[model samples]
Target: MSRPHVATIKEMAKFHTDSRYLEHLHKISQDGDNDDPQSGDFGLGYDCPVVEGIYDYATAVGGATLTAPQCLLDKRGEVAIDWSGGWHHPYHPVVGTGDLCGTGLGKGTSLWMTQGWVKVNLWMTQGWLGVDPMAGDPMCSFNMTPVRRAQCLQHALCHVLSCCVSVLSFHPVSLCWSY
Candidate 1:
């Protein structure tokens, strides 16, 4: 809605998706040939056809998925929503499923958490333990590290964004807030 923030090629590459695959998709979308028998390629024929804006379409969809979380992280909104997201499938990473970069979300969140961005309620903190009481919870019992908890939260947030209207409040480090 806000002029549509789009993720650049480099940003998407952080997910470790094969860059060549992305490039090929772009090429096929343009005047380049997708079904080149000379190279023994059969990727873009049916099911995944080589349309006019294939590359832009993929990046736009992927962009929506990435941007919503960013809005929350930037403190721009308590909850960010991307209706187009929830289920992402990029064939370059894997066949059919396209979720090899699934680890990308966790990796990104963990990085932010280390920088004191994401909230770590399940982790064993020096002071406030947040919602999860240190009574008999598995997160505290195992003494999970902040990074691990951040990674777990990262995965959970992915589902949360996709799920219909779930309210979760994550606080930045030092600046605490209600959940």
Candidate 2:
């Protein structure tokens, strides 16, 4: 598949204040190494590939948020999709130093989501139904037994699918699903 349009560091910095985290993220992008120790301690372990495309993912979402408003305003039927963009947990005014605490710094998925939600709400208020299929809460059962963990994931997936189907059944618009 073709790559989505990614946002630049300058564009992303507008939503954040910590220059240090942003610098580190920039380095990661330049180096293309998610396990870069210089990325501080918030690295997503050694086996996860989530960190590899984190910057691009964030950028894609940011791009979507930036243009979604205009798209909806110009033409009420415009459909914008950013499949890799939906972090949903990170917050703003990140509080940390050398190593980001909480949900880690530069993970502005939540920031993008917040902005996107506002635009989406605008669309919905204007009688448009925006279908965002971002299901399966990642923090289901991190400490459960192996078998139980699998069950929890399965259950979460089912719940997410059910919710998506229910929403689709009601509102028929652009469908964006993120697994």
Candidate 3:
């Protein structure tokens, strides 16, 4: 397994934010104070905390998530592993509505499922924050059982992190996102 190119701070910013957020992050990093009064306006100090070196952390995570798609786009591999997958949910996209998943045409990841996840189990493994029967509420997700829970969590992670693609057709041959 080779490492893909790490995305530049500029690139990550282009995809997710602009200069304002980056500037705020740098200011927080320098002062080591994440308790800015207007932090909520910047979407920080909420679910995402404003930590020291948050700029670096955010870039690293973005790079890691971009790795799988980069590898596929570069034709470096058919299967790319991105442990950072499944956590960052996009604002809006398609999935459950697509005919590919519900028509029993092919298996898919819950990454695209916005709602009604509890209804679909045949095409994909029960997955993500609320979809997995074992995984409970979004705020405090994951199971309570001991050994079996661990195994199940691991299984779900594997499904989340790995994306398999058919080189011939360029489709997701497995539970993964392909370029």
TM-scores of the models, in the order given: 0.44, 0.42, 0.52
Q: For residues 1-179, could you state the per-residue lDDT of candidate 1 as single tens digits?
A: 33346778897786645677667766766755655552235355554456677678768866876766666556665455554453243434322133432333322222232433255332111111231322233334554444554455455445332221111112321122211
Sorted on lDDT, best first, the list reads 3, 1, 2
Q: Model 3, range 1-179, lDDT digits (tens) per residue?
A: 75646668677666555577667776787788867886687777555777778766666666765776667567775455555444343422234332343433244433343343345443223232222223232343444333454454454545433332211111121212220
For this target, which candidate reaches the highest lDDT against the unseen true structure?
3
Candidate 1 CA-lDDT value? 0.46
In model 1, the Cα lDDT at residue 23 comes to 70
Whole-model lDDT values for every prediction: 0.46, 0.41, 0.49
Q: lDDT by residue for model 2 over 36-74, one digit each (tens)? A: 765545444443334565666667766655554444455
TM-score of 2: 0.42
Top candidate, metric TM-score:
3
